[model samples]
Target: MMLLDLFAVIAAAVLSVRGAPALTQDPQAAERPTAGVFVATDLNWGGDTLWIPDASNGSCIVLPAPFYQGTSSFGPDKGIACSLWYHDDCDSRNPSFGPLRTPGVSTQADWSNATYNPNSIDNNGIAPNSWDKQVTAFNCWNVGEDGLHID
Candidate 1:
């Protein structure tokens, strides 16, 4: 029927829109120019992007299956970085999730001060010897005023 054809067309359009780079933003962070986190599926900031809308206030986040170890970038600050761990270290926040590995961290592979911009502190997560394909759970915090990285 003609109605069925119209429904199919509408559905196709909606699906196409979903494929675009969607910014699932949080209104609180939207006010700040540099607030959320950007995790990409490939190095050099290429490929699919997973945006964490609330990286400024400190919290633990477990990367969904699509973004595991893909690589990450913080808000527009060279000093801002996320503490990345190889296994699921967010047990309290994510009680149901199991560790992807043995639930530990390799300092060489897990970068605590991981920034997209390569710096002297080994901040780059996408580097050859960094957390490129190994990150699972990460802790994000405000730039300063922090006793702990994640809360």
Candidate 2:
């Protein structure tokens, strides 16, 4: 009986190990956005580079560089010092919405043109000017190769 129990345990362990790979690989199995999926930039002020994902709200998944906190036209410098200029979707109510669907690099200009720009900003340094200076997108993904997904 003890031997039979040991064999059952071993079989369970083997099955678990075999199943582990399937679970782990499931995310990759799904069609994921490739690297450099989208680009992000500031709209109101041209050349004010925006990262792909905004780390402030814990939404971004990638970025180009480690965002730095520096004083700028926006308020006190803190958090990932970049705009959340673009995303895959327009509606914030949905989790999967972002910029992937939108062709071309996501830019502040695109965000500014959106109807929902005003309510997106919290007056924080990162999203300082929702009315005048729009940053962030509804469905955008991060492109930072380093995997620095958050601020």
Candidate 3:
């Protein structure tokens, strides 16, 4: 009986020590950031978007072209403002993922440049908008399980 008890204790200790790293390691760890492409269309603007980590670069997150529209900002008059949103760890490297014209505007005419607006909004700024015509865009990526939901 004494030998059996000692063996069980030793086994438990060894298992615990061996399993510590696996248990502590983040299961949802984001892969190294890299350059990737995503597209947002008129149909799914209100739905959620996913941000998969890039395997190439360790600190960059690629955004889709239509990720931000000027009109989606303060009001309809502003149009779609070119913007990017990601975790603070993301570094913007690709310009193509930045911004471009909306298609109808002449290529010759210089318009407003798409801004690098980070989607890292604080909890206090998430109040619901009262405007009827406003088209609000959200950053569904990188949000943990406790994030707020858009109705």
lDDT tens string, model 3, 46-67?
A: 2222333232222333333343
Candidate 1: segments with Cα more than 4 A from true spot: 1-34, 72-80, 90-130, 144-151
What TM-scores do the predictions have? 0.46, 0.25, 0.17
Estimate the lDDT of model 1: 0.46
Stronger candidate by lDDT (1 vs 2): 1
Local accuracy by lDDT, each model: 0.46, 0.31, 0.27
RMSD of each: 10.9, 16.8, 18.9
- Whole-model lDDT, model 2: 0.31
By TM-score, the candidates rank as: 1, 2, 3
Question: For residues 1-151, what per-residue lDDT tens digits would candidate 1 score against the true structure?
Answer: 9999999899889656544243333212333455555665554344565556565454667777567755543222222345555556643322121121111222333334333333223322344345445667766554433333333
Candidate 3 wrongly placed segments (more than 4 Å): 19-89, 92-151
